[model samples]
Target chain A: MARLGRVLLLLTTCLGLLGTAGCGDDYDGLVIGVVLPMTGPQATYGEESWNGLQLAEADLRQAGTNIKFKLVLKDEKSTPQEAQTQAKTLMELEGAHVLLGSVASSNTKTIAGAAKENGTPCITPASTNDNLTTGNPWLSRICYKDSVQGGVLATFALSNGWKRAAVCVDNESDYSRGFADNFKGAFEAAGGTTHFEYFKAGNADYSNVIQGVADANPDVIFISGYYEDGGPMIKQAKARWEGKPVIGGDGLDSAEFLTLIGDAQNPIYFSTHFAPDAPDEPAVKAFAERYRERFGKEPGAMAALGYDVLFVLMDAAKRCANPKSAAELNTAIGATKNVKGITGLISLDNPDRTPNKPLVIVKVEGGAKKFHSTIKP
Target chain B: MLADVLLDGLGLGAIYAFIALGYTMVYGIIKLINFAHGEFFMVGAFVGYFALRDLGVDEVDLPQPLPILLAFLVAITLAATAAALLAVLTERLAYRPVRRAGRIAALLTAVGVSFFLQNLAVQVWGAGARAYPEPGIWLYVDDLPAKADADYKIRERVEAVVLKGDAIDTARKAALRAEGIERVYRTPDLTKEGKQGFVLLALLLWTPVLWWLVKRTRMGRAMRAVSEDADAARLMGININLIVAATFFLGAFVAGVGGVAYCATYGSVKPLTGWIPGLKAFIAAVIGGIGSIPGAIVGGLLLGVAEFAIPALLEQLGWADAKAFQDALAYVFLIIVLLVKPTGLLGKPQREKV
Candidate 1:
């Protein structure tokens, strides 16, 4: 185990070197430094986000673009405070012209301030808080807002003729709380009765809530938490609910979720930014195929968005004459519109840089999540 | 709803009581808190998991009651043995040298050992919580597995093929959209009860067995004698060191049982699985009177009932929004105990001559 960890550390160091150093003498002078939670509670998201960038780099090289930018990666340790500290190091110490990522909405909020203060363009791949980009023009996100996510879920549930619903939300996280609150409002507004239970991340017991929800006996159970908490909760629920559908947001989208649930036959649905089963264009299909070949697993929504963030940044850079200037890069990022991505067409024309995109319902089939349907926003 | 909540609390409290046994027993024999007791619980859990899921029987091949019973026995025995050995090692290596180096030194070492073990588990398993095999009852129907190994294999194969599919997924998506959401109405509230009853029964069974060991066994007598006065007991040819080691072993054995029961109830295990639960159990031990076995059990049940039932009751009172505070409730109780009865519920007030 120690040896594996050492190897992983070595691999990370190598990847970091490859990202920051010019591959050859002809490499461009642009520097895009990324800060992500690579080693803490949110490590999986960071690893996936990094893979997305690698895949994006390969795609850019294949396109034969003359523009070359070195990448510098920093670990945020999955906390807003760490993100705040790391973002400064990336901008000042690493001489980063542009910044992207550091997942969770709270961390993105911190990065947002750093970008504004540093005058460097920062694009987040998957921070969904509605307030993330409210006043920070230097920041943008590839994913949809948490507010819209919950409403979309309510629409999906009501559309399916399921009137009664019971829910669980991870109140410790703003992302989970945002979606759960929004879903409750939307569901009730549409005249569906609902019951709500609450939990937090890092907690293992949900028996009390499970029993309470089981008694409520709704048509479906909505879990507004990440895969870590959602996975076991579903298993416990399945033992009682007897095949009831479990719905969640993009937070529930992880390969580990399947590992925890372990062959549960019950229907599990989650709303996500991207679906490998259905793509908006042929490029998406190609990207998915290449990602599978490279990583030995299908790319998740975060990876897809991470890939899109790169293109979005590149598109912004292509339009800029003075690409090396951080201020110029910031301006170019703000003007981004209709850049093609494997997830969808990237357009940051909205004032807060919110993307006008589609959301899909992914159903857990066998052990993998497959597209159930798409909702146009 | 109240009854269900109570059952849940009782079940959790039962786990706490078992873990608390280790804390209380060790403290009783030697005046140490054994901060690494929680890690011992975690270690025991992992050991049981390996024995049952990785060694004793395959999840698919197990034929109902027989395999489950066998697996449970194996899990119990293996976990207890590992925990006892771990306790002995920790005492010899980390505690023995610091035994006369002041209480604070031993306490610091205990904390360090706890952290070391947690990080070690994280390195071995990664940070993700691995799924524990489902309880035997969940799979059994008339003493036989409800699903065959072939069914499990096929499902795995189907998942693999679908995940790898670029062409097949497109075809499946078209079909999925048509039958998308199956319409169902509200289920009967009373129709489902959580599996806490099983935990209650399992825990209740351990009470008498532990009572027999403590009251009627030779080791238990030595343990009591040492607790009274180690120096005096040693002077009488009681082999004080052996008695202390035996106490640690017995305590850890109870902790091992606790670690196994906990994950079996929760459905998953992680490197830090026992951290919070073990902490709460220690609090339970304190409230029951830190060095008292009966105190630990009583304290554990009380803490469990409060943890589970408080949230349920609060939710009913329109304060369901207070879920985050439930974790803090145990600490609150701890503070209250310190203020009201420092000696604990079953503990006698200590008299210091100084």
Candidate 2:
């Protein structure tokens, strides 16, 4: 009986120790996890975002903030399955207090789902799909949603007196369809006519689609595809329909797009997040200058958004009572108002955590994207 | 509109034919469908891309047609050589040992090899699409209806000088260069049609050469013998391995040429570039009667024309989502062909022993 009592005591003691070990109270400082497509087709955006984050890190260090934190980055490889796995690792293994990432909406959706399940705050740098933050309290974006940009483009087109428009969309991308559909709806509601053409991503030929658009004889063309197809399509379209103005949403903003269009001076315009040369935004200009100095390449909307996203996260963390607690940080982020960002004056005080940011229009001329105008949202 | 679509189809068909030839040739010698053949095409394209972008092929200071010709020649040759080597290596390492294995095993091995090559490419060259160096030859389309007066004046200044049928002296060319017109537009024969014709002519010329090689040469006879009965050929002291390797070499060399044609026309190359075209070419090969060379050519042209033309027809018929169904329609065509003629267009039915 005495030996049995001693064994029960040992068993209870071990169970108590294991339970305490499993509790794993949050880390001493804050852990911010970054998931991006560092490789695969979307690597260009991933690389730019990474460069922006590096600049953000530099900014933090230079400012000499006393916040104890670490930033961990993982490559999603442009696959949603990989993104989920990485997000899980970031949350459970690294004990991330916050999550930032994923350029495209499809992958971002997967990451956000994982973040919600883990009760971690997730901020996407450039994903602009309308339904991302619909019911997910933990999800938010630094950039404007698809509806805003789509509506803005429609207004811009109407203001320019382009009544008839042809919108080309990538059939494979939900982002493309969402943005194009929104634009089409808004444009038609505004008493404009729209013709739709479809193309798949990774297709090298756009001549057939370009011909179809030319046959429609619209005053303007809207390419709702990424830079990969958009650039070549614009090049071909300019050859076929010389004078028709081509416009697109933020998907067309990339360095590769410029290279693909290569010296074609046709009137091409795209809506983007931030414009370095927009004279009024001194913050944008300074950020662009620093990005160029740091990376030696022109910073696109994505890079600027990446920089802004990190700062926004840091700002929210600063407001948090317990910065290491994800719930606290998330609440703090939702309360963000008038955070001066490179993109614009960001405020996420509304129901959905999307910033009411200004959209900038850029023109492709003389082999570079020049800032043309900014539309207030 | 039909003519334009057909020309575009023909250009696309030429690329399919180049890849289809490889599929047909490899299946002819050894009944294994070489799924990795597409990667061979991709490898060739990357080699060509590197040659143009990094090897200073574009920096060569040759005049007019010479530099253009030199660039194409160098890129194609390097691409072909690399593709051929990779094919031979693939056959020796992956296919050779699996030859005696059942057909399913060999097929599964081919798929494995395909995945290996794709991931290898992704590892080495990255998954991003790289812009191909445009040879700076503007395609001249004379049939494009003349624009309004204001736009026509600007077009005239930048239009190709070759349209006048007058020889461009070096000094006048220099003057045009100073005006930045020569850079925008130059050389009538180097137009898009000209490039397509060049690629098609090269591809078409090879059919006769391939026929002459297989029908007349000793190596050709040996390949036929091995195809008839590998055991018999081995017993007759013929080196079946050498013949199979040579067949892979020949097929991959052609696929490399196809790679160059594709990238040159498309102006970009990525690791996944080969996947769809490869699958389509394989379908073309099947449609042409998988083992027959001439059948691949015919099937490729037919499939290419149908793929482009049907969507165009649908578009004209007011089907807005016609292009969305483009890929689906290609498979539908494949299914229809299979149902109509199970043996394919030119395939001879084999006698089955009960």
Q: What CA root-mean-square deviation does each model show from the true structure?
A: 7.7, 9.4
Q: Which interface RMSD values do the candidates have, in the order shown?
A: 6.1, 13.2
Q: What would you estimate as the lDDT of candidate 2?
A: 0.82
* Fraction of native contacts under 8 Å reproduced by each candidate: 0.38, 0.39
Candidate 1 chain A lowest-lDDT run of ten: A19-28
For candidate 2, give the lDDT of residue A277. Answer: 86
Compute each candidate's TM-score over C-alphas.
Answer: 0.82, 0.87
Candidate 1 residue-wise lDDT, A1-377, digit = tens: 43554475478679868865532234358888899887656777888889999888888888877677877888887789989888888777767788898789899889889889878888899999899898888888777888788889999999988899998877678988888888999999999988887775666778766776787889888998888888888776655767888899999888788768764557889999888878445777887889899999878888898888888988888999988887787778878888877667777887988887778899888777778888976
How many clashes show up in model 2? 0
If candidate 1 were superposed on the true structure by all CA atoms, what would the RMSD be?
7.7
lDDT of 2 by residue, B244-339 (tens): 999999999999999988877776788888888999999999998898889889888888888889898887898868888877887898889989
The prediction achieving the highest TM-score against the true structure is 2
